[model samples]
Target: GEAGRAAALEGLERKVKAAMRSTTLNRLAPDLEALVRAETIAVQAGPRPSADESVLAEIRGAVLAGRPLSFIYSRPGAEARSRSVAPCGVMFGRANYLVAADRESGRIQTFRLDRMTSVEAGDGLATPPADFDLAAFASQSFGIYQDEIEDVVLRVTPQGATEARGWRWHPTQTLEDQPDGSVVVRFRASGMRELAWHLFSWGEQVTIEAPQRLKAVMAGELAAAGRALSRAQS
Candidate 1:
């Protein structure tokens, strides 16, 4: 996809160059030269296509047209597999495409565009709920897959909060200062794996404030990791 987008940009650059070359009139030389330089610079600065544009285009068209699109897609750290999906919509964020698919499982499945290949659109269509909003859907998500929605509150130490303030992991993140040199972040999200992983990276600087289930899971994971390390040395 990156290659395809880059190639498309390159094609535009060539056209601009050809136009500049074809226009030999000295009267418009100054403006044409400036335009040519600008085009060249823009082309150079454009992001390289890391995804297949055709796949993106086809998927997007199908979603908007209310048709089912099929493709070979893979999850993070997974092998690509063929999937037929009734796409509710397409979302672009976190440098990946999030597609809502209707399946026997009530939870929606998210797909990474870079992992998709040979995407095709089918004629069958399904209208998504009028209330469905992709942006709102991803407001609290860290990556793609959203399984179970819940309100997750986290208390970050002042130092941790300071580090988190500059970066936005979720759009719905709400921050509040704490007296004990910490901050509380309140947000609603479904998938917590990525966030759990992020919290683990912070060590003990942050603490889970709500949803005892997640906190317990996180604690268990850390405890198991500690035991694994202890066993390795013993």
Candidate 2:
């Protein structure tokens, strides 16, 4: 029911070529509708970050050509400015991002693809750092932004333990079955706030067992949320 990336791209190409042949909007409208609103083959776009495919395509091309990219990056409450960055790779997670090393600082950074403007590829081949690994860089953070990685341990209540067994908490997680019918989840990760927010959804079914930092974060988030609710009620 859901179209994969390759299939979706191919379908889009077909729709574009069909539109190009028509001279007027009314003339192209019918054919375009049929291609998109198919009767038998229902096309569904799966969960992926929204952005201009044109920009993504250009970056993909630059990566293949081993060339750097230039673009005006916008920061919140600040002016937009241009930067040349070595094209390391494009990472797709909750959102899409261009991960690279700033040509100035030589330190790696991530720019949200949606915030980029006036993108252009450099003439010279991109020279990434000798020891930079995209996977390693990404894995340093529990979610997106990097922080101190710590050993996180969570003990699931007996009632929720069965369901938690089927959950993939993390790629590098270890799950241990306790004789008391509860499960202990352990993993090394950063981004305590994100983890805390997620565990809130578990609704007391999950309990923190170690890493004082995670417990502190969870308590802080709970207190903040409580204060907001109190203010709203008052």
Candidate 3:
């Protein structure tokens, strides 16, 4: 049984190595490495103070036992704050372990593992609601933004479409070919800021459809640029 497990792992590694030979995966490999290195460096080259392993172990135990935790957390650019939350799940985001918490407001919150300064297990909090669905919660989410969901449709010109032919933007994305030698891509996203910026980078080759608001935002940006050019000429 042990030998069989080792062979299975080696087979999986080979498949991963084969997949990484593709262009998109190859480009992302370095960024993934950097993220891991950054997390390791933080843990290794820390100041005299280090995170308490006992606290971490207790937090893990609480999560497994469906208990709550109160901890001091500091946002990337904000002051440190105290929070009381019920532990739900732990997920790996890039190289960080994100702890999902059920807040007092009945909404779920995610906290970065490295940003937690102090953690303490608390008295038993209510377990996740009977109807709580983790898969649906993350279905339309792009990265961590989960405010509102929008139907985004993009028309990419032939050249741009060719560039995106085999790329996977999201699991639910649908790509269709249009008669005018352009490609139409449609997907539902909870956050559009990242996708909007990505489409904007394609310059005039991509057009935003369906959501008039996105087009309006792009038009305003172009108008501002025109005004800036006019001011410079004068």
* lDDT values for all models: 0.71, 0.83, 0.69
TM-score per candidate, chains pooled: 0.68, 0.72, 0.63
Deviation (Å) of 116 in candidate 2: 1.5
lDDT of 1 by residue, 2-66 (tens): 57667889999778767774555555779868997888432433223245667777877887788
Residue 13 of model 2, lDDT score:
76
Regions of candidate 1 where Cα sits further than 4 Å from its true position: 8-50, 72-82, 93-95, 103-107, 114-118, 223-234
Candidate 2 structure quality by residue, lDDT tens digits, 132-159 = 9989888766677657888999999999
Ranking by lDDT: 2, 1, 3
Candidate 3 lDDT, 105-169, residue by residue in tens = 67776676667866877776646655666666666765555656778788889888887667777
- Candidate 2 has an lDDT of 0.83
In model 3, state the lDDT of residue 88. Answer: 65
Q: How far is 188's C-alpha from truth in model 3 (Å)?
A: 1.3
Candidate 2 regions off by >4 Å? 1-8, 11-48, 75-81
Predicted structure with the largest TM-score when compared to the true one = 2
